[model samples]
Target: MPLPLHLLAVAVFAMGTSEFMLAGLLPDIASDLGVTVGTASSLTSAFAIGMIVGAPLAAALSRHWPRRSSLFGCVVTFAAAHVVGACTTSFPVLFAARVVAALANAGFLAVALTVAATLVAPDKKGRALAVLLAGTTLATVAGVPGGSLLGTLLSWRATFWAVAALCLPAALGILRGIPSGRTEEQAAGGPALRTELAQLARPGLLHVMLLGTLVNAATFAGFTFLAPVVTDVAGLSDTWIPVCLVLFGAGAFAGVTVAGRLADRHPGRVLAVGGPAALVGWCALAALAHEPVALLTLVCVQGALSFALGGTLITRVLYEASAAPVMAGSYATAALNTGAATGPLLAAATLTTGAGKLGPLWTSGALLAIALLVSLAAVRGRARRRQPLPPSEVGTPGAR
Candidate 1:
């Protein structure tokens, strides 16, 4: 028996809400904790660091555990950490809780992706992943904004409690829904840890991971500073920022849906189209930041392109790393998180150089252009090897 895909989506929703909601509540949290906003912002960095460190650790430690049990433990720990965060008044204690939650988040996401791939037919892997990631997309659209509103209406603590409460249904669903067995490959005595590591070290797989990292870095470079872009550059009032965010989220949701349908049939084509679209979108955003209509349109297009590229990248990685999908999934997660952490730093540095509000847009456009070139090189390299790619990887439907 297989677990219901919706259950996994629900679990991802809870985890993603916790991961992203902090951005919306930073000011409220800072005021309540008597810390400066800059200091409070470190909490987000801490969560990203925890994810980078935790994904590999979880993959290593839980490789031999039953998949369902491992997922259950992570969800419970994540919920408990949120409870602690909600109750804590001290900044350090809340930060610690954030780190713990992020560790659990990393573990759960890695396992969930592996399980999703296993549950579906090879041809459906891209669609399965798209459904799973839609949860995160919803988190950005609904959870983050709702959490922000909850904090505004009550207190930031209430928002934490609300997130913790969300975990209960997700945990119960996992416990009851996931079938009792090792994952598909693991049940057949999957490759040893050393073997998986060696597979992960392949040059082709490394190129794919690098592409994933670069795509995320480009997306986040502009996204991290979107509020400032909206107000300072687009000349929009602060009140319109949330509306802009919702628009971005809507575009992401739509992009993921379309990518899910097309990726299995055209993985390479998806990347080829999305990478250039994102580059154009970012450059347009840089030049037209002061034009409210153009700025809004570019923002939505940039959001769509980012997720479209991401979906294709994940499908490609899974195809290339078929021998040890679980561990490979963790590597992908860690790489993306590393890029997420790096992007904000890059944007901040650009701003410091007096590049003005357009700094992040131009910076992200440059990164996307480089990523596009790398992607093109990777496609050509894979073609030159003449190795038989999976049907999905070859960008043909039913090639197998």
Candidate 2:
């Protein structure tokens, strides 16, 4: 709705395209680098690891910096990493590049959440965040597919080069368009990192983190092995891989849009509905892997349910924390990264144990069940806290 929002959107679009392209281009990259596909896949893993380690580290390190400047710094770092990745011939060098880019991407996203939240009214926070998040969704629906096609037609390295080029204009747009508002100045001193840590000591917040962990694990369980499942297990062709991913993306886009709107209206209901749907989808995905049409149908359902919960859950965590918005954003993102890292590792372990296509889906279903329980617990905990409050006070709310 605002110019700053558009700037943030553009930045997110470019960054998301850069990050997801690696997955689509993994085959080309691995072949070129003379490495195994699993080895090449580690670049994605490394990036997530970096984000888990980077969110708080960047937030703490840049405690006093202006939010706009911090965003700028992140883009600069991202651009540099992309440049390295594009030019480097060695797999190790490219892996390092991805790690650097991931750290910067996490920092930028953390700051952007705070910045976007400040730009809109309290009532519009979920919608505003939805707009910001749309960039990433669109990348999945559009950018990743395009980059993959380009990589298939040309070179994987070219995709990285294109992303690097995008960052230059994105940085310039941030400098010229996005307002360096005064909120950053006021927000700088709200709470020390230690105070934020103490607040996370609250059981509610801790459970939220655990919920994030489980939900993400559930997502990765099916997703990490999606390519192989669709190809080898389902007997689909490799040429159709992007098509399947785009189908998932279409589902993700719809899910995110619905979640954002519903969160703006009734986040609690969305949360309530999400878990059961996700659990069902996970089970369905596992069961339908051998049936081509059923597999695609189930994959779309699973993708929609899994990602739709993202905004709702993140917004819930931010509101519950209510300590420091920026800090909360950082912490929430870290929790997400933690789950991301865990999910793939768990899936890998299952695959190693001869579970094949079924392992990830079963593991994900279990994790979703766990997340569902935690979410119900959170709802119950909130209800218990609100029991003593006045009706007028109890109905009021905030979105991170």
Full-model lDDT for every candidate = 0.80, 0.78
Tens digits of lDDT, candidate 2, 217-319: 6775566567777777889877666777777777877887888788767986876888898898888878878888988888778768877787777776677
- Least well predicted 10-residue stretch by lDDT in candidate 2: 179-188
RMSD of each: 6.3, 5.6
- Name the lDDT value of residue 272 in candidate 2: 80
Highest-lDDT candidate: 1
Candidate 1, 373: how far from true, in Å?
2.9
lDDT of 1 by residue, 236-306 (tens): 87556656666676777788888988888898788877888889899989999899998888877877888
Clashing pairs in 1: none
TM-score of each: 0.88, 0.89
Model 2 alpha-carbon miss at residue 165, Å: 2.2
